[model samples]
Target: MMTVDYRTLFADVHRRPGSYGLDGSYGQAVAFIMGCDAGNAWGLLVGFPEWLAMKAGGGANLVWSALVLRIAFPGPTVVTAAETLDQQHDEHAVGALFGLLDEFLADRKGSRGAAAIVSSYLDWQRLRREQNS
Candidate 1:
């Protein structure tokens, strides 16, 4: 599978001025996002609802939500990518985002990340059991 660095992808999205409704310290958000790794690197395209529940309260992401509601994305990948790009920032939200991403990426990258082409069925089995129980 092809790998994508969500951090790079989102940072680029942030680069465009007047394109977001983010509410936070720009430098700090950039710093935080740059430091995070979505498995292989910083940035990821997590579900929009997940982001909203984690961060947005009330209408924090109303603009993007409006857009998403009105538009039809090309596919699942496009929808996910759009969600990442359309993401708005909240200082509190971004911090929480990192904590969650770290936990998630660690599980995804454990062992396999150490060596390319590596597989860990034992680890997978443990995870499967955890998921089921």
Candidate 2:
């Protein structure tokens, strides 16, 4: 099995998503990332949604992609799912997704390492569970 470095790949994708046939759309970029995660046997995105939720002030119900969308388009607007999807294809939302992803990756590479981040996420999850209980 070949090891894939997703951090570098994400940075490259952010730099030139068109090179990866992404059409500069957040939806397409997310789909591409989903494909990559699906191919990785290790489930690289296992706790990413929780991490994103922590960052974006979202709850467990929202996935990482939704968190990205919320961060990009913070204003609440009444729109159908299709309308929202269309709107998310804009450059602003795509930029936010990749930019946030870069930040997330950087945190994972911080001094304490990915394990520390995971520990923080676990602590957050415990707190949320306690609050719900």
Candidate 3:
């Protein structure tokens, strides 16, 4: 499996603020996405044991778990924005969020790692839409 550098991923996300939302602040968005990804990943990992136990019968559990996980998590897991935005009042918070996301994305690998990144982005996008609506 290929290695993924989350710092780079965060930087990419930061650079592409237009993708997640119209705002130019990639840091805050990245932070939000990272938090969402962490939450989603935690849920998946926590459920793994139960999924494994249930599949011990004919290994069908494993297959089901894999399928569910795949759907729960998708590739290029980055955020996408369906609208535009303006500047924020606090740059410090944005910087801090960017830093946090950078750290989280730095240590991941393979599809799951990619999924985490993408998942976070989508979560942010969803929030942005709801807030605007």
* Backbone clash numbers for all candidates listed: 3, 0, 9
**Candidate 2, lDDT over the whole model:** 0.72
User: Which residue segments of model 3 deviate by more than 4 Å?
Assistant: 1-4, 25-40, 43-88, 104-133
All candidates: TM-score: 0.25, 0.75, 0.32
Q: What is the lDDT of residue 68 in candidate 2?
A: 76
Model 1, residue 11: C-alpha shift (Å): 7.5
Q: TM-score winner among the candidates?
A: 2
Q: Cα lDDT of all candidates, in order?
A: 0.38, 0.72, 0.42
Q: Any runs in candidate 2 off by more than 4 Å, and if so which? A: 75-89, 111-115, 128-133
Q: lDDT (0-100) at residue 81 of candidate 2?
A: 25
* Root-mean-square deviation of Cα positions for candidate 3 versus the true structure, in angstroms: 16.1
98-133: candidate 2 lDDT, tens digit per residue: 788777767766674557766877888889789999
Lowest summed lDDT over 10 consecutive residues: which window, candidate 1? 51-60
**Model 2's TM-score against the true structure:** 0.75
